[model samples]
Target: MASTKLYCFAQSGNAYKAALMLALTKSDWEPVFVDFFNGETRGDAYRATVNEMGEVPVLVEADEKLSQTGVILPYLAEQTGKFWPADAKARREVMRWIMFDNHKFTSYLATYRFLHAFAKSDPPVVAFLLARVKAAIAIVEKHLGTQPFIAGNEPTIADISMCGYLFYPKEEFGFDIAAENPNIAAWLDRIRALPGWVHPYELMPGHPLK
Candidate 1:
């Protein structure tokens, strides 16, 4: 049996963050598919047994059941000694970007994509989110131009966290993000070339939302 189990669905970018970390680190892990679209996450059984927060992307190892990609990514890095900087300063930089990702970058983009593709939220709401997403992407685009990765020269958990949602099809997002940002596109290409890289859709279960 795999030593780690990640409760996740294919379409969740947050889940992808943890899944990607496990993959890139070459951890002996397996996915426990979460039926997110069919209201599985919100169910009482899942809440009682898996996570009280009722969220996907929970990482299970022995007796530890850890939720939130912010926690999962760093835990995996610590355990595997991959995608984490050895330098104390660089580790702080990684945390900074990870916080930024959870707060601004991934938060805005994931919200916008969810409302646009799934919720079919009102245009005004979608536009509001899109504007913020663009703003966050602009910051990343500029930052990536100066360095090959988010935290520094080496690929770290920050890069994994930031690129969580970017790998999905443009149709789902209703726009081509890479086409507009050359720097981000190149950065993504670099990440793609890494060993054990896998697309989110193929990395987990519950694709097509049915």
Candidate 2:
């Protein structure tokens, strides 16, 4: 087994998507924490070396580096033969949900949570993102109403993708999703029961904010 290293920080759910996959797959991997809160991802050094996109969750194996949660999750699934779909059609279905997660589902919710809690940006901007957040959550709620997971009956990278950022505390966004969205809550509970399930804060480093 080749040595693996993940460039990540504790607070990023996007990073946790890949980190959680590593844990679930029982991969012999190590973490290289990115100082995100102190503007590390925005710096020139990180961009020049780790990832030109200046992002967290860069999975490095040998000399190759992979980023983006959608790509990273599927790559790990294929490599480990753990969470990948069984057929081409199911594979496409998984990709479809992963695309939705990257574009429609996680994007809006991540932005809303950041602006509402961490960023503390303008009120109008926060309101706009909050509207998008609700819209996205409603769609997921309706979809999960008829299914156990996002891609299919089984848990896949799609579920990992969409569930990112959602496991955060309700007070962070000043809302309780478990209280408002029962379907989503049930789905999250299902995912939580999976083997090797761990909170993002517990799995990764640089938490407790020294």
Candidate 3:
């Protein structure tokens, strides 16, 4: 099979999800970094290769192009046969959580993090963002209370899809995952210690990995 090529922006969690999966699966691929701050993604050259949405985390496989972090996770999992579940029922569960991450978690927490951490914050917007974060965390904590992993016992695409947004609170917001949700906190530590779990900020401009 031909190697896949992923085009991403270094500072983005959405992009990191694809990169992390590639590393975990031990797949051979090329990572092209797009400069979002410089409008590199909107360039004609990039648009021709990726979705017209101008988003990062675009995966190019031969002639195919894929956008959205949620879609990229399962695609990589299915291709590599690594994180995806084999059972029909299990696979559905994996998809369920991935959708949850996109519709529920990423919609709010990721937006909140991007706004508060990167852009100038508005007090009203920050308040609204924090409410969403709390709501998302409550849902996660409830789900994680019983299952060791999001999709149950072993890690799956669900975990990878949610890891970036989940980790953001602890590292950036001075919020402790352990204090907020012990189960998720432990899970966070395990993910952080994973083989290819590079922090997004570490790859940002002028920042060196510790």
Candidate 4:
């Protein structure tokens, strides 16, 4: 396997998805810290040299540079041949959950948490985001209630992608899925028991906030 480096900060669950996948796969990898809290991601130098999308968690391996947790997770799954669906239909199932995660689940929850906690935005805006977050979480909670994993019976890249932000502290979003959603909680426990599973804070830098 080629050497892998993930551009990430500890607070970024987006980066955490890629970082966690690398860890779970037991890949030879290292994290290049991105000072996201200081606006490094917004700088022109970083945009031009790194993601160009002003995003952290760019995965650099061999001669390829990949951005977006949705893409990076699948790429790593393919490379490692570890957390992938067994057939075409199953792969489509994985993609469905991954896309749902980006569009509805993690995206809404991340935005809500950022505005409500990190950015400390207005109450009106935070309330609006919170509605979306709750709706998305309900959908995920319902799905997890019936299935052991997001994609199917086994865990896949889809599970990793969707779970990117789910492991973060409940205070960030002001709710605890692990406590309120039994199935989701059980699934999280399973992921936690994986051989190399580690919390996002420990897997990357920039913890405890500055």
Candidate 5:
């Protein structure tokens, strides 16, 4: 197998999803940190190298590159034969949840968390964003009540993709994600207990997860 490299922003949850997959798979790869704040991703050199979209979490495998975090997670998992389900039906189910996360949950909740928690945006906008987040959480809470993981009993690419976004709001924004969804909380605990599980930001001393 050819060597792989992942270029990502250290603080981004989207980027962390890719890193988490690489770690979980025990894949040998190099992680290059892109300085998003300084427009490093937008530079010509970076644009030509991996993603023209100027996004972080670009996975480079030999001569090929992948840009989106959603795509990167399953690709890595499938390559490693670890988290991805083998059955076609089960894989489709997993894809359903992953697509839902990409089109629905992440679009609203992740954006809201990003704008409100980190950007320190307008209060009115934050309030509006919070409402959307609450609605999205309600839907997830309903689904999680029945399913052990997002798609089924075992963890899959869907869980990996959604986990970081789910974690960030609770950790940084003081959002009670677990309080609203008890089942989801249980699932989160299960994933946390998995072998080789590590926080992407573990380099930060005194991280709360410790």
Candidate 6:
């Protein structure tokens, strides 16, 4: 068994954030697939034993079980000394972007995609989320035009967090994000070039939703 265990499914970008951190840091981790689409997360057993928050991407190391990518990312970075800034000031900058990502960037995009692709949500609700997603993406798009990464030239947890939802298929979003945003496309390219990078479907189990 690996030293670290990540509870996740392939369709969850939030989960992918932590998985990416573990992979990039070369941590000895294994994925524990959760059948989220099958209502596994809502079960009493799962709520009791795993994460009571009813979320995926729970990181388990020894007796420490961490939930939320915001917490998991920083913990993994601290543990492995990777994907985190060395200076305190730079770390602050990374945290700023990570917070933005959690509140706006990934939140909007993930919700929009889930509704657009899987939930079959009403037009009005989907439109609202889509607009929010576009607005959040535009902020990052412009920001990346000025810097190679979210916090600075180097890739940090902020970059990984911000990129959580962007790698999914364009059809899932009902549009092409990369083709529309050149700077984001370039940034994604750089991230893809990194060692130990893996697509969410290949990295975690439970793809295709069947």
Please name the candidate that would achieve the greatest TM-score relative to the true structure. Answer: 6
Superposition TM-score, candidate 1 onto the true structure: 0.96
Which portions of model 2 miss their true places by more than 4 Å? Answer: none
Could you tell me the TM-score of candidate 5?
0.88
Residue-level lDDT of model 4, residues 69-175, one tens digit each, is 88888888888898997688889989988999889888887788888779997999889888888788788889988888888788898888888888988898787
User: In model 4, which runs have C-alpha deviations exceeding 4 angstroms?
Assistant: none
Q: Tell me the tens digit of each residue's lDDT in model 5 across 12-64.
A: 77787787788777778777768776778789987886688888788898767
lDDT of 1 at 96: 95
Off by over 4 Å in 3: 42-45, 168-171, 201-210
Task: Compute the lDDT for candidate 2.
Answer: 0.88
All candidates: TM-score: 0.96, 0.96, 0.87, 0.96, 0.88, 0.97
Model 1, 68-129: lDDT tens per residue? 88888888888889999898988999999999999999999998999999899799999999
Model 2, 4-63: lDDT tens digits are 999998878889889888988889999999999899999999999989998888999986
Candidate 1 vs 4: which has more TM-score? 1
At residue 38, candidate 4 shows an lDDT of: 86
Clashes of each: 0, 0, 0, 0, 0, 0
lDDT (CA) for every model shown? 0.93, 0.88, 0.76, 0.87, 0.76, 0.91
Better structure of 1 and 5 per lDDT: 1
Q: Per-candidate RMSD vs. true structure?
A: 1.3, 1.5, 2.8, 1.7, 3.2, 1.2
Error of 4 at 146 (Å): 1.3
- Model 2 clashing residue pairs (backbone): none
